[model samples]
Target: MLDHLITHDDNLRMVPTDRNELAAAVGHLQEELRALPEGSDTARARVLTRWIGIAQLCLGHHDEARTSLRQSLELAVTIGNSRAVVATGLNLGDAHRYAGDVRGADALYRSALITARYHHPELMDFALQHTGKHLMECGDPAGARAHLQEALRLRIAKGDAELVKSTQAALERVELLISQADASATGHAVPGQWSRQWTAWLQSRITTRTPSRWAQDFPTVRYAVAGLTAHQRVHPCHLRDQSFPSALLTAMAEEAEKAVAADGYLHNGKWNAATLDAVSLFVGQVDLADVVSRSSGLAVEPPHTAVYIAYEEGQRLDFHLDEFGFGEANLILCLKHERPAELPRASTTVFLTADSYLECDLAAGDCIVFDGALTPHGRTPLSAGESVTLVCFGFRAREQDSRTVTHLPPVPSGRAALGRPESAPAPRCATLCGHAGN
Candidate 1:
């Protein structure tokens, strides 16, 4: 009869996110555990207790979560339920980490990661994600990125949007931390930047005179501090020193075309793929972003404002500075270029300098990294049947990211510029064309 009651209790294995719902569930489970005879059904009790512990963890009761999960973990080990043990270990590790026991958290996450790899590959991302977070918190940005990226790939393959989002958020937070650290190292660090916690870490790290294992243990942070130069604001750096992975670029171009076509853009403007959650999630990967940020000296956010930009016949841009929020540092990577004449040169010209109008013809895979806010640039009117497709990645200055939820930058008015025929109406864009009053 007692086994029957505990068996029925197994059906209450829901992990609710609501605080009130979680609290009620925790309380109910506790009551049930007290009612049960000691050692009546260890298996069922472990299952129930695991849920209770995780529920308490979600409820922000870290101490309680640790106690319950530790107890449940022992039961799982005793009963030989390795999977449950792995699962409970993850939550318990999170509890430890959150409660300021860094070493405890590190141990559990490492253990869980290894166990999940062999026993339950399905939960590998869960373990990997938490481990990555732990690594970042411990000041190892590169290791954190590597782990998070792998975890993201797995979560994406698993087709769980929520799980993917969780990993992505952690990855982004880690990326931002590296960028901020890079900025500080280059003597261009923004005073009082985003993330108080990250700022605090940097403050202590920068002043440490005694040679810590900085180069060996936290090489990513070290590289960000040593390998980069203060980024140039006026003259654009071609980044000829580094090679973008061709395979990734190929995949990105293919994905960009499909995404832009499906989500059509303004006739001669842009399609903001950053708004497309899935496409944005895939193309703007951590590998490309990390390189760009280190080279550019700006703490790049996930290219959430990334766009598919284009201009058709008769489209021209007057030289103008881009506004700050969306595009302070801009990466213009040409994806595709087509023209009626099979000219060996690029049909469209980018004026690197507005005063002198220095023209540069860019080809596919040629990326130009420049400060859009400080550099005056424009596109010349395209000849007949000429179209240029570009993928633009933009990041705001780190200190400038103090946007309130409602304080969004005004949308780039998708309007035709000065050269548009007066008879024709301004083309509306699925994205921001970025050429307005110029």
Candidate 2:
């Protein structure tokens, strides 16, 4: 569909601007939105509205796109659509940029980025690219490079050829600027101390911690895993006491580490079966029930689990909570590249629980737990590679349901010594089944 749109969209793009093809598309989408039953899957309506925003943007209707995107974002939020929010945020920022408000555009881009960090690292590539472009436009090539590198990492994971090509083009521009800065006394394009400070502050707001008290007030958790069982070895440039994979975390970690070592980007980056397999591996590790409960303090029953994966640069899943059946427990896990940080905190994991919100700073090898039933969850855009995570749902079981429940191994004495409640934690041994990888 995207390919078709891209080729055919040129015709639409070529239409006379005065004739207003955007309004026609907007009208068609509005009709679609109106025809859907009130409260019928909002996802569809949101998606349609997103297309309308795209059309509006392509047709150079920045104001219309902004209006439509705002409405779309409101609907997404109403429907608990995180992906939609991210999409709308991106569109809104783009509208601002095209409308010649770079600062506003940057702010909106940053907001979208902050939202994306919580869901999937895959879409962060697109968000990063756009944000990087914005940063470059704002005279911060270093920040642009940082985001572009992340985007490139995700795209490499996804094997997205077009994105890699375009992103490389952008990177080349930044590289040239850096080179020029090095060669000329007054041409230093790298960010100054103040820009670095501001960027760091912005990152901390999104990746390191909850941006606002409101987010902290409503907490949710994301659960993800990889069935990595082998030890890989690596000398740590930062950690003095331990080398990576001197004890391996999992076989999967080898893939991740390899990608990271290669800087997590592909040369040609054409989306291929291998990239799909990587995404599958990522989702296979997702445990939605565990994510929801740990983050929101909610309980999930057994017998209902589901997972989905998105692989396109623009492909996205909207924000939503499973309110019916076994979907009560939900969470999202993002497989993203690790950033080099002195503190080892590279990612920000947001837990949206009922009446509470918590964003935890994370890095590779760290895990976050949260409840999904109490709060809604979804990813932004998958800009680079396919973002993978398991989405498991557990249903309340009846007394007559005679399923054998495998118990967790007894808590080690040392763990018990850490003051874990014996009876309270006993459920892990019997009630919640530990994963035996496929």
Q: Which candidate is the best by lDDT?
A: 1
Write the residue-wise lDDT of candidate 1 on 69-130 in tens digits: 99999999998989987888987887887778999999999899879866786788888888
Error of 2 at 423 (Å): 77
Worst 10 residues of 2 by lDDT: 224-233
Prediction RMSDs, each to the true structure:
16.3, 21.3
TM-score of 1: 0.41
- Give the Å shift of residue 394 in candidate 1: 28
Model 2: lDDT of residue 361: 35
Q: Across residues 166-249, which tens digit of lDDT does each residue of candidate 2 receive?
A: 777777777676556543543322322222332232233322122334333221111100000011010001111112232232
TM-score of 2: 0.42
